[model samples]
Target: MDREFRYTQKDFNRARAFLLQLTGIKLADSKDSLVYSRLVPRLRKLQLEDVRRYVDYLEQHPEEEEHFINALTTNLTSFFREPHHFDILSEFIQRGEVVNRVWCAASSTGEEPYSIAMTLVNVAGGFASSAQVIASDIDSNVLRHASDGIYPLEKVNPLNNKKLFFKRGVGVNAGKARVCAQLRKLLEFQKINLLDEEYPVKAGLDVIFCRNVMIYFDKDTQEKILLKLLSKLRTGGLYIAGHSENFSHFSHLMKPIGRTAYIKL
Candidate 1:
């Protein structure tokens, strides 16, 4: 929908600066149109006349910050979106002698953590019965959906062990599935901003699946985040990244042990 609002270069700059200041996402100049398109709905919803006015409203109303962040943040995730990582996770569990604590640092819409939970459940008997998974994200909106554990039937069809982890809906709830209570019990969904200096998780996490979200940050922010994630991981623990994220430059903190997977050294 074309916004009945004016979106000027100055306004775009202001919006970009605001997003960066709040979310640590540095938008490229080319993203001006993208930002305009994304925020136009916000302006319409708030009955604001222009991007400049929306900025003013945001500055005045700090409570709207969550809505602003939610509006711009992208939440594209699915169960077992990256299958190879799950394979690596399974291997790690098989070789481990102790119980593992896993954290899905950017658990957008809960798919990655759910996938991790499925793997954990598969190996629970032989690997370790005490394994736990924590799924977290900065966006409260997606976390709510993740916590609900409801997904469209088509979106979850690709999961490898469908019958084991999901219950397909029938009758009035047809064409959807709810994550079975057994699998859902393994995950604790919460809100977590990566830019924060400290996380609430305990030390010595055995696995941290922080996929796809790092591409949004610049090199400096990426390094800072890497350090924080590494600190939370135990020695010989694993840190999984998105296939597109190349952290080879930070060899001091972690070394690549598999495709887009690293071991805390």
Candidate 2:
């Protein structure tokens, strides 16, 4: 098959290796097409000859690394995705747990963390709750977008307290809504590379929602990140994993409490 730009096995291998080294994310052999589709735009933007040139440009121009990672990293998310997790959180709060400090480890476009803030607010009956949510991601671009707290109506409409939590846009801004100041205030966004030597987040968090992120890593990288994340979560605190992410292998560190959710031991 002919593509607009030159893409070879070597290019894919080099790019995937760099990505793994920089982010602890492993790309499978089947991801060549995926890589091409995700990266062609970057090549066009940089006016590069091919994927090989893009890889060389990445190494030569360190500033290009961010754009490269942003291009490849998946940011598929929706407001209140996996509603059951929020239900579990409500139950935890009702059961007399004071969940004050929470972390959303991969807060793609801010939906997950914002959903968390909404849940905490609902449980506490207002914005006066002591809960604070720290939302972080590896992509700087997505972090900025998440910090804005603006989304299309399609994403914002289904939220039960949409009116209370978000303000509708009108005129040129129609069909969009921005999270209310009260809702936005509950969260702080930061750029965090899971592969970092030391996680900059504070220790002793009450809950951690690191869902769906471990799937990108290999076994050893996953275990390394999980251990670091667990150190930040207090014992008996809730640690939520993605639906497909099973932590049963780490039973000694955490125990499954609900669907793909864990309790730090």
Candidate 3:
């Protein structure tokens, strides 16, 4: 088996089809280089000679599915990446609403959910104690990192309440920060593929943060995922989306309340 595997169009198509089937993420033809870069490492690790062999291995070994998904999925995220949504959340909390359960649907590397947790802790007033957030993503590797709750110091330095939600490392551990125990207690990290017919989360969610993820899917897949997410959202509950997303198709079910934020009517 050669380590320098040449990924052909056929190889790219096969891998793309399998990924789309499993995760509903339609890889564009232009992603040929990106696919090659991500999957070649997998080929080497699995002792396979080429992309075709790797695809065959994927079909034969269902258990390798998680590794395959972990390899291809993108997990770009940051704390409070969209600050406006958090502002809306703060206002929602202040309104004395019944917001007990929150869901960070694409909780890549834990930033979005942690930001949600910080908002609840800081702005939810007394209601923060009873609230819980479920943070999930398709990538098992990123889920592990999210659970660890450690980030570089610079990531949290901009946050106003950095000292409250994160513990700044000292002595030998300087220049690093870890999520404090109080904030970590409010979040649960799990592996969830939105392509699934149904999620394991409890219904009546108060807030759903399905951010910066749907942009990877086509229209049909996006609509299906939105419908499922809406079913889990309780009446008057909020749904936060990435700034670039447009849920105009589901306007009958939800009304826009703010920039990329919606409320179930």
Candidate number of the best TM-score: 2
Model 1, 59-110: lDDT tens digits are 9999988988888887898778879999898888788634468999889888
Give the worst 10-residue stretch by lDDT in candidate 3. Answer: 121-130
lDDT of 2 at 157: 84
Q: List the residue pairs that clash in candidate 1.
A: none
Model 3 misses residue 252 by how many Å? 1.2
Sorted by TM-score (best first), the order is 2, 3, 1
lDDT of 3 by residue, 161-249 (tens): 78778888898879989999888999998889999998998889999999999998998999999999989999999999999997866
TM-score (all chains, Cα) for each model: 0.94, 0.97, 0.95
Query: Once all C-alphas are superposed, what RMSD does model 2 give against the true structure?
Result: 1.0
* Ten-residue region with minimum lDDT total, candidate 2: 74-83
